[model samples]
Target: MPPHSLLELHDITREYSLGKSRVNALRGVDLSVSAGEFTVVTGPSGSGKTTLLNIIGCLDRATSGSYRLDGEEIGDRDFDALAEVRNRKVGFIFQSFNLIPVLDVAENIELPCRLREEGGRNQRALRARVEALADAVGLRPYLHHKPDELSGGQRQRVAIARALITEPRLVLADEPTANLDSATSQHILDLMLRLNREQGVTFLFSTHDPRVVAHAWRVLHIQDGKLLSGEYPGVSRRASGAS
Candidate 1:
């Protein structure tokens, strides 16, 4: 892996076993994401986009080949080890907004720090961080509200804040805007783009939404468990005269 590469995958493959058959979710995927790159992997349903993101995010392991994150070889780590790495190095945002229904916005954003293997964080400092992230994601006003109390866009904002609170090296968002309306989706995408640009956050998204693809800094196309070689680096909505 290059010194500047935040993530590298070499010929990665993943397979699943059924009662009497097998499934190939990924095959020979070679990818390297440089630090702070806002890249999106796009494909139709069942195109392995989610599988690839899962492997990269450490939520799942590959059946073959190597995976390096921050120059560390972690593909073969056991479940417990992987969990540790995930809590320390990766953040995730999901389409469902995955916020705990009972927890208020502030508590949800602060959850990751509490779950860390090292549990001696200062309460004052953690609260400060959570509040800062909430402000950054436009959730400061909703800090005391539960997930059920916010609108769809505001809930997604909370999820984004939660993902960023850990300051993870990588953030994997799986179809994050799937439940949002078109206008709300654009707002969410703009928020992500701002975060990526201002905080140097590295984001990898798996989605079939053309609107999301339109905003990506780099787009990777996948089909049949293989990545195709077309990228629109630095091309986006602005280039197409769309506001």
Candidate 2:
């Protein structure tokens, strides 16, 4: 693992048994992510991109090899330990918004804080936080609206706010732009980039879109269940500028 890496995976491998056969999702994959970096992972379908993200986010354990978060070994931790780590240190954004249809925007954003029991944030504070996040994502006008009442883009903005509600050290987004149109996708990407710069929040995402990759400070390319490139250095200007 590199020095100052907040997340590290060393020779990690994950496999699932399908009847008599074994399907390897990841093989000897190594990666390190540092603080304040926006890293994008891209590959073809069935290339283990989502699997890798799940492992890194502590949502699933690896079959073999060492995985570390903030220098703490996570592969060997129990389920409860992993859940705690995820709740306190990691936030997740998915392509499908995943907002509760019955919950209003502010309620959805406050769900993480409620789960963590980090009280002392009275309704006023919570509302302020939600308002600030909504303003940032342009969702302030829909605070009382439920998920079913909002458009796909609005729901996604609510999801982003919910992900950041916990102020986690790391945010993992899987195909966040997949549900939006081109214009909305660009807007959301810009929001994420600005948040990364302003809040110094680390971000890792799995995406196939070149537009998404263009916003990243680093890019990892995976092939055949292995990390094929993006081991050293960060994003290149030429690559960033490429269409």
Candidate 3:
């Protein structure tokens, strides 16, 4: 593992049993995502994008090989241990903007802080965090609104705020802009980029959008459970082009 790598997967393999047969989701895949890097993973459907994200987010375990997060080996941890790691170290932004319909923006944003038992984040501190994130994402005016009352873009911003509430080391965004329009997608992408740069928070996203690919500092192309190429900015235009 590289010294600066916050996440590392070494010859990782994950297989799912289907009756007497097995399906490989990831096969001997070696990947490393360094701290403060905005890395994007792109591939066609069934290309192991979500599977890889889940493994890195500690939401799932690989069937074989080694995995590490922040230099700690995680392949041997149980499900509960994985959950704990995810809660403490990883933040997630989903395509669907999984906000509770009944909760207001402030409540939703502060949810993660409350979950970790990180006391002393009183109502005032929580409000401060929510307001800062809302302002960052251009959702400050909607702080009192419910999820159903906001537009798709606004709700997604709320989700982004919630994801950052914990100040996690890594943010795992799985198709975060998939549901938004082109203009809205650009806005959301810009917000994520700003957060990654300003906060020095590492971001890893799984996306198929060429726009998303264009914004990434590094791109990983995966196909059929294999890593085909790793493209860094200005290195390989052909490889960077989305397939």
Candidate 4:
């Protein structure tokens, strides 16, 4: 692995048992992501985008390969160990905006911190950070509103804040803008781009949205369980204010 690499995967492959046949999700995929990269993986449905993200996010293990996160070998870790690494090192945003229906915006954003079992968190500091993140994401006014009371975009904003509140080393988002309108999708993308530029947040997304792909610093294209030869730095780096 390179000195600055935050994620490295070598000849990774994933297989699933479906009914009576084995399904290949990934075929000898190799990838490397350094800290602070704004990258996207784009592919058609069933082309392994979600599977790849799951492996990288520690939600699922590859069938065979070596994966290292921040220089630590974790491909073989057990479920409990993977859960620990995931909680401490990764944040996630899903297409469904998985917020609790009963929790208000502020409560949803602060949930990750509270889930930690250590229990030494400074309550005042946590609240401050939560509010600051809510403000940043344009959810300050809706801080007291529950998910059912907000628009789809607003709920997604809350999800974004929740993901960032943990301050994880990497954030994995899968079709984050799928449920929003075009305008709302653009707004969400802009917010994420600003965060990536200003805070150096490393983001890895699996998206079908071309607009999202257009803003990426790097793009990886996969197909039929194999990576095509389209991995390259996107031309939007300077135009999008990426450092």
Candidate 5:
């Protein structure tokens, strides 16, 4: 295992039993991601990009192999334990910007702490953290605005703030820029890159978008449930013509 790796996967495989035949979603995937690294996994629609991200994000389990998150092996944990690990150590930013429509920006960002009930039960400190992240994502001015009141970029920023609210070791984004326009997608990517640089937050996201892949410092190619080694910004066997 690499020292201080936020995520480590060894011989990871996921198989779904389809009647009598089995479909492999991931096959012997070995990957290591260090803390504070910005990495993107890219592939075609059925190349298992989302499956790998889901496993890394603890949303699903593997059929076989070891997974270490923040120095702890969690692959064998039950659903409840995995849920706890997710709430405590992992954060997610979805493509749809899954925010509560009625909750304002601040409330949405502060939702993680409320769910965990951590931080020594100190509301004041949590509020301070939320504000700091809001400022970092440039959402301070819109902190009181509802989701519908903000632009797509602004809503995505709010989601980013919420992801960081738990101070997680890893943030997993599934096609985070899929719902945004080209310009807004680039803007959101820039903000995320800045966060990774300044705050030392590790980000691992999956996408088919070449624009987003181009911005990653480290690019990984996944195809047919395997990790491919190459000199990227090149496309994989399954990808064509830049998304």
Candidate 6:
């Protein structure tokens, strides 16, 4: 593990057992992500990109090797224990946006905090924070509007706000802009980059989108369940005029 790495995976590997077969999703992959760094993991479909991310985010346990998140070794924890750890330590943004259809924008952003300990008891404070986040995401006008009332870009903004509701140390995104059009995707990417730079929030996302990779300060490539060096580096706003 590198010094000051908020997330570290050492020789991590995962295997899924079919009834009569075994599938190796990750093969001895080691990675270290420091705090406040915007990193992207890139790979083709079924190349273990999501699998590696799942392991780091504590959504999936590694079959072999050591994994440390926020300085604690977590590879050996059971499912329930891992869930608790993940909820407290990491925030996730998915490809689908995953907003509640019935809940308004503010309510959706505050959902994670509402699931936390004493969240209900601190309702007023949570509401205030949610409103602030809504404003920050430029969704203040739609706070009372349900998911059906918003466009794709607005919905993704809501997702980003919701992911940061808890003020977690790390945020993991799985192709968060995959469902949006190029223009909307660029808008969403700009929002994430602004948040990362302004708030110093660490972001690690997996994507096949070169546009997303173009903004990443560090890029890690995976192929055939193994980490491989690629020509994805030297990419940034300064390098490619991508924001």
Model 1, global lDDT: 0.88
Against the hidden reference, what TM-scores do the models get? 0.93, 0.92, 0.92, 0.94, 0.90, 0.93
Superior candidate under TM-score, 3 versus 6 = 6
Candidate 2 lDDT tens digits, 1-243: 432789889999999999999999999999988887888999999999999999988889899999989878889998899999999889999999888888899999888888877645586887788889999889888899999998888888898899998888899999999989999888888888878877877899999878888667778999889997773234463245321
- Considering every candidate listed, which one attains the maximal TM-score? 4
lDDT of 6 by residue, 104-200 (tens): 9988898887776646787788888988888888998898999999999899899999999988889999999999999999988988998887888
Which one is best on lDDT? Answer: 4
Over 1-243, each residue of candidate 4 has an lDDT whose tens digit, in order, gives 422999999999999999999999999999988898888999899999999999999999999999999989999999899988998999999999999998899888988888884225588888899999999999989999999999999999999999999899999999999999999999999999989889988999999899988877788999988976655556556456554
Candidate 4's TM-score: 0.94
- Rate residue 129 of model 3 by lDDT: 78
| Each model's backbone clash number | 0, 0, 0, 0, 0, 0
Model 6: lowest-lDDT 10 consecutive positions: 234-243
Q: How far is 6's C-alpha from truth in model 1 (Å)?
A: 0.6
- Candidate 5, residues 1-243, lDDT tens digits: the string is 432878899999999999999999998999988787678888888889899988888889999999999889999998889989999998899999999998999999999888887646887888899899998999889989999999998999999999999999899999999999999999898888777767778888898778777766579888899998734442342144222
Please give, for residues 1-243, the per-residue lDDT of candidate 1 as tens digits. Answer: 422899999999999998789999898999998887788898889999999988888889999999999989999998899988898899999999998998999989888888882236488888888889988888888899989999999999999998998899999999999999999999999999888877889999998788878777689999999988858756554255332
Query: How does model 3 score by TM-score?
Result: 0.92
Residue-pair clash count for candidate 2: 0
Predicted structure 5: lDDT: 0.86
Error of 4 at 201 (Å): 0.3
lDDT of 4: 0.90
How would the candidate models be sorted by lDDT, starting from the highest? 4, 1, 3, 6, 2, 5
